[model samples]
Structures are given as C-alpha cells and as structure tokens.
Target: MKSPGLTLVSYGGKRYRFDAGALCTELLTTGGPGEFARYESLHEPADLLRWVERSRLPSGLEMPVSEGELAETRALRNALFQVVADRAHGRPLAARELAAVNLAAAGAPLAARIEADGSRGWAPGATVARLLATVAREAVELLTGPYADRFRECGSGNCGLLFVDTSRPGRRRWCAMEHCGNVHKVRAHRARRAEGDD
Candidate 1:
C-alpha cells in the first residue's frame, strides 16, 4: 500500500509522486547488472508514479484489503522491495550512460557515423553520447548533492516507507499524519502509561 515519505515532482503540468520504487529504478537497482544496463528495462517515469499511487497497504486500524487489490498492490510492493534490497546490498549501478547515448542517437547522424567509422573514433554517435552523458551526470550530481538532504526515508515504525525531505528544516519524518503520526502518538501514550505503573 501507499507508504509515507515519498517524493513528488511537478512536470508537464502533472504532479508525479516518487516512492522507493521510482528512486530505486532511477538509481538502477532493479534486476542484475545486465538488466539494469538496458535502459529499456526502466519503466516510464509516468508509469512509475501511477504504480505508486495505485499501491497502498492498510495500517493496523484500517480494514483488510480485497483480494484483487491486495494482489495488485503486493506486486507493486515487491518491485520496491527488490530494488531496496539490491541497493542495501550494493548492487552495481546500471550503465545509464550507455542507455543515454543510445537514446540521444535516435534520429541523429550518429547512426550513419557508426556505419561509416566502424564504431571507432569521434563521430556523431560519440558526440551525442558525450552530450547525453554530460547532461545525465550533471542532473544526477545536482540532485544528490546540494539537495541530498531532501532524499529521506520515513521514520514510522510500521511502514515500509521512504520520502523526500522537503520540509523547511529538512526534518520531515512521517509521510502522513493521519497514519504514521497518529500511530506513533498512541504508542507513545501507552508506553508512558506503562512506565508510570512501573
């Protein structure tokens, strides 16, 4: 189910929410080296957001999920799970640069250059590749650098949550107050009562 602490981006007049799944995919944590190496394996950014919005698990107080929705949600859950595990275990980063190069070469002189030069030396393909690589690298660097703190995981004990820390203080912890925050508060009150009796 939709966990707390996901990030949202506004692009093309639409708001795209990014959860652990998108982050892991963006970071190329899905599949083995070869799979991630092929950028085609990556889902479209919009699809990723749709997937996140559609998947949500019930917290303790909520009713149990229906069978159909449960299965669909679980599949989405598994996607993020595998990605997180890969990242935690230090899986190799995908060859995104190569993918970027291939994408940038579409409809350009790069295809002809490859045929002419036998894939060697400076050519249209190489130029496109270089430019694509530069842009991708810079984008990633900027995201994970100055805005590094904005990338965060949720702190709720019961949620498999992750979120971007976009709060003014960059101290955001919960994804939603209606869920995790209330759960935590109740837990704390119970804990305090127990402490008082002892």
Candidate 2:
C-alpha cells in the first residue's frame, strides 16, 4: 500500500522503500534519461496503471490510459526527473525540461471525491493525462515551494536515488535510514577497520 510521501521502489529486481516528499518526484522512479533508461517501466498502458496503484495518491483510482497518454506521461516523467536532479545538485535548471513538464500540466488534474463511507476517492472518469497533470502541477509547486531547496540525491556515492529532505533539521542524506544509510555506515566501518590494520 502506498503511503503519503513514501513509495515502494523497484529497480534491478530489488525493492526499497523511499520517501520522495512529493508525488511528483515519485513519478521519477518509473524512469528517466541515460542510465535511468535501464529501469524504465512505462512501456504500455497497464504499466502506468500499476505505477498509479503504487503512487501516493489516494488509492482505488480506476483510470483509462491510452497509448498516447502513456507516451506523454513518459516524456513528462523524464523531464521532471532531469529538472529535479538539476535542482538537487545545484545545477541550472534546463528550460527544455521545464517546458516539457509545463506542457503536461496544461490538462486539468484529477478531481477528488468523498465516497459514501467518507473515504477519500478519485472522481470517476479518471484519465492518465489528468493523473499526470496532477503530478506535473505538484512538480511546479514543489520546484517553487518553500521547501524546494531541500531536494537532494542520496548521500551514498553509488546511489542516485532522489528525494526531498523534509526532516526538521533538513539534513536527510539517504533514501531511507534503514536502506542506503545502513549500507553506507557498514562500508565506512569496514574502511576504518582496514585503515587501523596498516
């Protein structure tokens, strides 16, 4: 089950729990440009549906995804990924990437509703485009939001996972303390022991 600000991410056949701080950045886990292309999952309509299922959006969303919509969604995801990476690394954001994201945001976002049981729900007639619009719109908000400067990549040199550091101290350094952070700690301990043997 997807929780707000957290997602179960699968890459290279392993799953890691990630906190992306926003649904928009969570979309980046599906794929990206260059090395990220290897992890691409948005090949067809059903693929996008699965992603929606794992997303932070209130669940029970039944959306129709067209081939055209899938294509647009991938493009938006790649652009969003690049922009966030640039933002996290303190590089200048690219206009082309920003434009791609803005184009996707042109559609109306998914409407939310209250079910008979009082549970939050997505309105009927959901479209992939609309769902992605919600993502893009949030991307715009996050990029310009007060917490925008908190965007970051994992501190581990071998890991490229991205997230927003929402800690009270704003010093979050890895995807999760239980994941990459643990691995980094173990490696540093081994290196220290090796040095002591010299």
Candidate 3:
C-alpha cells in the first residue's frame, strides 16, 4: 500500500533502497543555487498519516496524527537531510543534528517483526511519535553506517535528490537513469549537434 506520492527511484543496492524514502521528504530543489522553492509533501497531518499507512512499515501502526506532530516530523526530516548532506560533502556531522534525531528516536516504540511473507520489517506503536521516530532511526543508521560513504547528490541540473551509489564501481551520478540520466544525455547530444552546425 505505498503512498501515491512516494516515488521510489532505485539507485542503491537492495539493502539501501530506503535512501529514496528518506529523500522523498523534499522535492524539486534543483532550480538554482540555494533555491528553497522545494515542494514539501507532508503539508498536513493527513499527509503524515497517509505516508505512515502507505509506507512499508509493519501493520497496526496507523493512528491519527496531529498538526503539531507533523511539524515535529518536518523538523526531524530537516535534521536528517543535514546529516546526510554533510556526509555527502565529506563534512563532519554536527552533534546537535545527531542529537535531534536521537531525541526523537528515543520516544519511538518501534520493533522488528516478521511479515506474512517471512521478511522482517519495523512495526511502530500506534502513535505519531513512534512513526516519526522510526524514520529518524532509519536516518541515524544510514548516516552512521558504512554505506554513508557512498552518498552522492544527483548530477541533474534540476534534480538535487540524494542517493547511495551501490554500483560495483561506485560511479553512479544521477538519482535515476530514466530521469536525470536521460536529461543529461539529451542535453549533451543537443550541445554536440549545435557545435557541429557552428
């Protein structure tokens, strides 16, 4: 029951596909330098609940989320983005950002459970804090884990999404080949044609 807006672009390997879930918090930030015109998907409490319901989380975690909880979730997302971005740039993660994620995760009632298909997944408590805490914990694990070294910002001029480069050679440059990769190829082809005409 994935959310309609939850677009999962495969970039990393199977174990790290959750990176796309983390980056889905923000959208369309590749317009310009420091462009903050990004479209936020979690605009309301209903949006948050929808995400929780549709996410690949354990069942029985759906609950009525409040506006205040939505605000807190946004804050958590920002902290995660900062940590991941810093790691991508080879900068040290700030202690305060890590603290913010840990504080939220401390209140989460998440547990590992086996799904009907025998796969393991996280099941959060029937509370807003727990749901958000699950996501925060994921960010913590990703930023601190060895895969963090594979972080790469998208090379598209208008797509600044982040992804883990799990390629064998570790040279992945776009968030998705069908999207940014094609864009780059087309642009380059056009430029070459223009040069030939000149």
Candidate 4:
C-alpha cells in the first residue's frame, strides 16, 4: 500500500514504489540534469503545484506559482542533483551548486500554525517562493545535519535515485527493498545458478 511520502514511478511501463528519504531528494525524481532531463515533469506551473501535493510536506496548502518560480525551481533542482551526487560519492562540494541551494533557502519558508482541532496547518500567505525555500532549506539541513554521512545514491548500479539512511543501523542500500533490492537479489541468484554455484 502507498504511504505518505512514498511516490510511485513508472519506468518503461514497470511501476515501482520509491521513497527518497528526504524532501529534497524527492524532488530529484521530477526531473534532473543531462540525460535525466528526459523525466522532466515541471514543464508547466500546474506541474509544480501537483508536486507540492505529492511532496512529503503535509497537505492543505494553497499557493500561487508564477512562470518565473517554475523556472527557478528547475534550476534549483538541477543544482541539487549535482550537490547530492557529489556528496553521495564523497567528492568536494561544488561551490556553484552550494550557492544555488543557499540562495533559495534564504527566502522565507512556509509558516506553521496550530489548528482549532489540534492539528498542524500552514500559516496564511503561502506561495511558491515559500515552498521552494522550504525544500532548499531541508536540503541544507540534510547535507549538514547528523545524517549527512548517511545520504547515499541507490546501490543499484544503474539507478540514480538518492536517499538518506535514517534507520537505526544505517545499513540502507537501495531506494526501496521492494524494488531495487529485490531486483539485485534475483539477478545475483540467477548468476549463481548459471554458474552452478547455487
């Protein structure tokens, strides 16, 4: 069953569940740089709104998104991709990518409010600026926080998804055990059998 923060992705007609483990990493799925651009889903403003709804952030936020924000969002996402890939591979942080993330995070994030029913809600005046800021801020935190060393690219050699390992042992290796992990296990088993080692 689908849970909050988990998004289903279709790869060449095969559907798989993906949990990016952090709000920022989740945005990487919408689109990315170079070859990843083929997966672009933010060609229109409505697309960004849809992404917000699907994001790990709680629902009930209404905001207006402009064409410029849409463009900015794509740029932020692209920068984030490089930042994450670099970090995951133990490389030095790229100054340009770090600057883009910091620039967006400088904007005001979405404010929080307590509802009459004792539930959490967003404060008034939500906007795409706040949404992007929230995402960028989270990226900043994830990159510098306790789990900074825990963030990793998917273990599948060909999978480009990134995730932070929040589990107690921090042994997470795949984007989702039900997806990449299983595939790896099956492939390994077949290889063993083919070699008469099974």
Candidate 5:
C-alpha cells in the first residue's frame, strides 16, 4: 500500500522524508544536503516514474515517460527551486526564472472539471507535460499567495529545506518536528548537561 505523506529515504545518518503538504516544496527536497551530499532521487526516467507514482499527483498521471521528458522535468524542478529560494531569501525572482516555470506550465493540457461531489477539480493530460504543469502551478500559487509570507527555511544545521509554516503561533523552527526539531532538542539538552557537569 502507498504511504501518503510519509515517504522516507536515508542519507548521511539522516532520514530524508516528504510531508506531501505541498508539491513544489516536496520537489525541492528530492536531494539531501551537507555531508549526506546531494542525493538526487530523480536520476533517470525510471526514477521519475517512481516519483510520479509515489507522489500521487493531482493530475493523475500514469507513465511511459521518455528520457527527454524526464530531463525537461528536472530542468523545471531546478527552476522552481531557484524561484522558491529567491523568494525565501527576500530576493526578487528573475524574469528568466519566472519565464521558465511559466513556459513549462503552459504546455500542460489542464482543464477545470466538475467533480462527483459538486466541487471543481483540475484534470490534466496523462503526460509529463501535465505533471510539470501541475507542479509549476503549485509553485506559482505558493510564491504568490498570502501564505508566501509564511515560507521558512529549515533551521537545523545544514538542513536547508524550505516549508510553509502553518503553525497557529507561526513559530515553527524545523521542517519536521521529529527530524530537525528533535535533533536540535537533543543537542541542546546535551550541551546543558555538559555545562552543568563542568
């Protein structure tokens, strides 16, 4: 069975995981950071297929993706990352970066459909273009929405992942409480104990 919102992969003594809350943010986290080095999950066409299947994209894509399409997806992913990183750092997004995302998003055959529950849903073509479009739409929405103000980079050492802080108090300090938060807590506790002993 597919485990939604809890995909875990290990690197450098740390378990890199996804929260499935946001598609664009999750795309940026396919690689781990620091001494764990860059662990790219989408290294090949098959890898991209796995990611698409695992992510359960809203576009409902099933894959017989080409290597060229995978390359394009990776390029789009990098562009989205740059856009998000710039926005998080309070820097203005470059025109070229925005253009790249917009151009890819335009290629997807997306349409609004009426759902069984009388709600609107997006229906995208069953192609890599559709997947890229879905992800690009997510990035644009995140970067331009009111929630953009809540974007934060992980505060853990060398854990540079970005997340939207949805906490009621808006004081979230880690990407995942069980991951970086616990690490910081344990480190602080050890430091305090050592100081007391000294």
Candidate 6:
C-alpha cells in the first residue's frame, strides 16, 4: 500500500526501494566486480545504506535477473541519478550531452511558437538528434517538477529518509507514521514525563 519515490521508477514499473547513493551501482550494465565495487565506493557507505533502506522498487515484471547483471544495471542507474541530481542543483549538463542540444537550439529552439504577427517559423525536430534531445529534456522536467514535489525529505530528526506525501492535505510528515513519526512522538512524551516526575 506504500508509494515509491521517483528513482524507483527506473525498472519501468517494477518498484523497489532503490538506494540513491548506489544509483551508479544499479545502472552500470557492462562492468566487472572490481569496477562495480570501485563505483560503489565513491560515496559514504553509511549514507548509501540509509538511502537503500528508504528506497522502494516496484514489482511485477518477470525479469531474468542475475547478480552480475544487477550490478551492471545498477551502475547504469547511477549515471542517470547523477544527471537528475546535477539538474536539481542547477549545474550545467556534461559536454557530450549538451553539444547537440546546443547546436539545434542555436539555429532554432527545440519547442517554439511563431508569433503569427510575423515571426520566424518553429522547427523543433530539424534533425534526429534534436528530437531525442527534446525527449530527454522533458523527462528531466517531469522528474524534478511533479515527482520531486510529491516526495520530500522527512521533517523528523534528520533520519535521512524520504517519503511520498500522499496525504489529502499534501502535508504528510515523516517517512511513515507507524515508524519514525511514532518513535519521535514517544520519545518526546517520555522526555515530558521525566520532567513532570522531577
């Protein structure tokens, strides 16, 4: 009954709690054990572990999964995760990624409108590369916009977890009320009781 975060949608509807820090590990498709391990070692193990705990991957696909393949795939996912992270942080896109997009936008914007009152015509897909570039642009927008707003970091005591705010008021607190939220409340109550006893 629980909802998943944006990163977990990578498996194409096969939901699972995917650790964001280990994104590269989940996405790299063609690599050996040493390579995968080195990639995973880039981040702090504890942080990645915490992210893994909060991540959720969907189920239902009949995947021919293997340990080796999973590692490679995770690495590939990592690459995508980095891109989203960079975009969120307002960093420039990598050189290779931007070259073609820049070239196309140079001549004419990818998605544009004519003023009709005498303006230049819009030619978005002037080339194949530009069309595919448009698709990638839209994908990133969808993720950081709707998806980012939907799932936010918990307001609890820095638990390093994120949850989907599916409440009617769109103000759900903590990753789960039965877990982190309840624990925090109980701790606060105990502290108050100790003060009263004193």
TM-score for every candidate vs. truth? 0.37, 0.92, 0.73, 0.93, 0.80, 0.39
Alpha-carbon RMSD of each model: 15.6, 1.9, 6.1, 2.0, 3.7, 13.2
Residues 1-198, candidate 3, lDDT per residue (tens digit)? 342223444344222122343422322121111343254667788876666655556345557778887777777767666666777778989888789878976775556777898866656446777766666766667666766687778887665676566577878887767667876999999999999999
> Which candidate ranks first by TM-score, i.e. highest?
4
- Model 2, C-alpha of 86: deviation from truth (Å): 0.5
Clashing pairs in 2: none
Tell me the tens digit of each residue's lDDT in model 2 across 15-134. 667888888888887878899998788999999888887778878999778899898888888899999999999999999999988987888999999889998998888888788889
TM-score of 2: 0.92
Per-residue lDDT, model 6, residue 169, is 74
Cα lDDT tens digits for candidate 4, 1-198: 125455566466666777788888889988899988988999999998898778777778888888998999999999999999899999999999899999999999999888898877899999888888998999999889998998899999988888778888999999888788998999999998999963
Full-model lDDT for every candidate:
0.39, 0.85, 0.62, 0.87, 0.70, 0.40
lDDT of 1 at 50: 42
RMSD of 4: 2.0
The CA root-mean-square deviation of candidate 1, after full C-alpha superposition on the true structure, stands at: 15.6
Ordering by lDDT: 4, 2, 5, 3, 6, 1
- Model 2 scores what on Cα lDDT? 0.85
lDDT (C-alpha) at residue 105 in model 1: 30
Arranged by TM-score with the best first, the candidates are: 4, 2, 5, 3, 6, 1
Identify the candidate with maximal lDDT: 4
By summed lDDT, which 10 consecutive residues of candidate 1 come out lowest? Answer: 55-64
Query: By the TM-score metric, which is better: model 1 or model 5?
Result: 5
lDDT, residue 117, candidate 5: 80
The digit string of per-residue lDDT tens for model 6 on 1-198 reads 124442332214533332222222232221223333443432433332333334332221122334443333344334444444345445665654344333333442144455566543434334323322343344344444654454444456554343334466776666456555776899999999999999
